[model samples]
Target chain A: MSESTAQNAGKLSDDTVPSALMDGEFLQQLRQQMYRFSLLQLDDPQLAEDAVQEALLGALRNARTFGGRAALKTWVFAILKNKIADTLRQRHRFVDADQLLRSDAEEDIVDTLFKESGHWHRQERPAHWENPESAIRDKHFWRIFEACLEHLPARQAKVFMMREFIELESHEICAAAEISVTNLNVILHRARLRLRECLENNWFIREG
Target chain B: MKKCRDITRLLSEAQERELTPSERISVKLHTLICSGCRNFGSQVDILRRISRAYVRGAADEPQREEDSGD
Candidate 1:
């Protein structure tokens, strides 16, 4: 466990609270954050919306045990993370964390090298690199990226998507993923490195 | 042992304004002298800008009240 995680764990164990009534406004805000959280995890806006609905129902039913020690948002995120995990587990048997990290690392290296060599730049410059201006026009590029992502283990993919695409705060990501701060950081680091390397060697240096 | 590449990994969070203080310092100082890290940092910065643009566009969506009327 990282120093920060150990610290967070201490804080969690130090305080305990039973239900504190959340007003309507609090609930609305909670719902919105959860919606975004789910969206980050699933990457499908509709699926994320559904996950929030399910999570909200779960929260409402379990409100009596809601500990006020942590902020309601934290508790709510914890629940939503579990819900997302459960959903993913049901849909995909398991995601191999180590393999996923390795694959991403491979791809990042490839992509980086590729870009460095100016192969992708020569291909027909993408109007936008991250999410091509026209996904249809850049379908091939996205397809390759997506295929690389699909090769990742589910948990790593989830962490990568949440941090990279969803842009969630690390603290919230830890809470949502129920991972320790160090583990979360490690996952994020591996994900970014792999993507960087992959993007460079494969897509960026395709011609090279 | 950490190398420039290893240190560069943390810059993604640093650029996102997400890294803790020590991390920010380590990544920042490393990039200053390491050409590989500098390039990596630039790439990450570019990606961050793109992500921010996408997220912002997500909000460019019409207001709830206006959409309800439509």
Candidate 2:
């Protein structure tokens, strides 16, 4: 795990936004980044676009009050996160993590992975994945990863993004998403499991 | 003896929860001999690393024009 540490993957590289807020080029660039992040987190291009616009507008409206404590990129991202949360709330897309634990259907997927004798089903056996570290450097791989993430059920994807994307600690996710610790772990475990299955099916084997 | 399925469960659980000492020993034993389980562990590790990078790299936002600024 140490050779492959990506958690807290480092802060936004450029903290400086133009002192001139609303510089067409800068906002334009920032808008695109915001939109991409929102889309990945929300998986709805239209809604993601809306969230970026709202976030930018809100940031500009309150631009004067910007105490320089946080990097501009961090500040903007903070606003965008709130916009995304609000959008998810309005859409009723937020999942109660505890509910995920009760969904017996998930157990069916896990069950199918093994035979009655508890051996790997041929299809479920882990195969040689081309070095994933190399794949991470390729821009196209991120798109494939995003596509795999989008394949997750709405609630599962949301929770997964919160813990993994936002990099919130498990306890924080439980508080914010109103899920119990057990439920949070269960959801996370499933997300990781399903994501591995998805990438294996969609990316790894396909390339092989 | 832990089955491959059992070892796989522990591998995923290790990502989110602490494994009991017995569970750790079982996984250590299984993965030591099992190439598939080791691949499984590294695959999950890969997934975790890439996901974090993908998220944080959004701050950099490569200069590609895909949206209409709508």
Candidate 3:
């Protein structure tokens, strides 16, 4: 055990976990953050609460085994992410028929950005974004990005998050969302278009 | 014959799967003339990168507070 602990510690970027992780107030804050993160992805309060509870319990049970390798928050979130995935998989199997239809019935945003001739709308054309790479390191940029993500229609945001943030394969997302490959592509296409437009309007263009 | 709208869909689809030769060719040809489609392609790529960065940064929030305090 000590051998493995030393090896893990060596492999990690941070050798020690901060004491703040142990503070009661900090733990409470972490719990709230986890709930918000899960809710954003899961979009169901009950499931989000259950996922957070299970993750926290698992973290507590495995606390000694944590070995001061990764940040406690990161470790907890890793567990929470797994919990959310499992919950999604389970829910996917029993997804309500009405919910599935509703998700499919939602109107597409693509039509608004394109003319009847399938060309870009004059006012909707994408503007040149200078140095978008530099925005990744800016905290304010992330805030705007998150807001833009939140602005996405629920189904679009959920599918987009599963693909991009959770790093799930397209097939996996299709299976989870009960969407066909073609349908998945359309949803992703719409999501990207809107997201690009939102960030361009809110951040990049505003900066210029 | 592909318009900017069709080219943008192909661009986004490329993220999910391999585009067929003709589809790829159409996108390549269309984007060459259409600055708007070209910009859309790069912006979507940026969206993917930003998403990954966001995931990594999510857990760093509290840590950032601690670092500033120290």
Q: Where does candidate 1 stray beyond 4 Å?
A: A1-137, B15-29, B49-70
Which residue runs does candidate 2 get wrong by more than 4 Å?
A: A1-26, A32-93, A96-102, B58-70
**Model-by-model lDDT, in order?**
0.54, 0.69, 0.77
TM for chain B in all models? Answer: 0.54, 0.77, 0.82
TM-score-wise, the better of 2 and 3 is 3
Candidate ordering by DockQ (highest first): 3, 2, 1
Per-residue error (Å), model 1, residue A130: 13
Q: After superposition, which runs of candidate 3 have C-alpha atoms over 4 Å from their true positions?
A: A1-18, A57-71, A93-108, B58-70
lDDT of 3: 0.77
lDDT of 3 by residue, A1-208 (tens): 3344445444533323345455678778888988998897787888888788888766655654333323566678878888888877666652457756765545445678999899999889998899977787677888899899888877788888888877778877778787789888888988899999999999988854
Structure candidate 3, residue pairs in collision? none
Q: Per-residue lDDT for A195 in model 1?
A: 56
- Give DockQ per model, in order: 0.13, 0.34, 0.48
CAPRI class of candidate 2: acceptable
Error of model 1, residue B1, in angstroms: 11
Say which prediction, candidate 1 or candidate 3, comes out ahead on lDDT: 3
Worst 10 residues of 3 chain A by lDDT: A9-18
Model number with the top lDDT: 3
Q: Give fnat for candidates 1, 2 and onward, in order.
A: 0.04, 0.40, 0.47
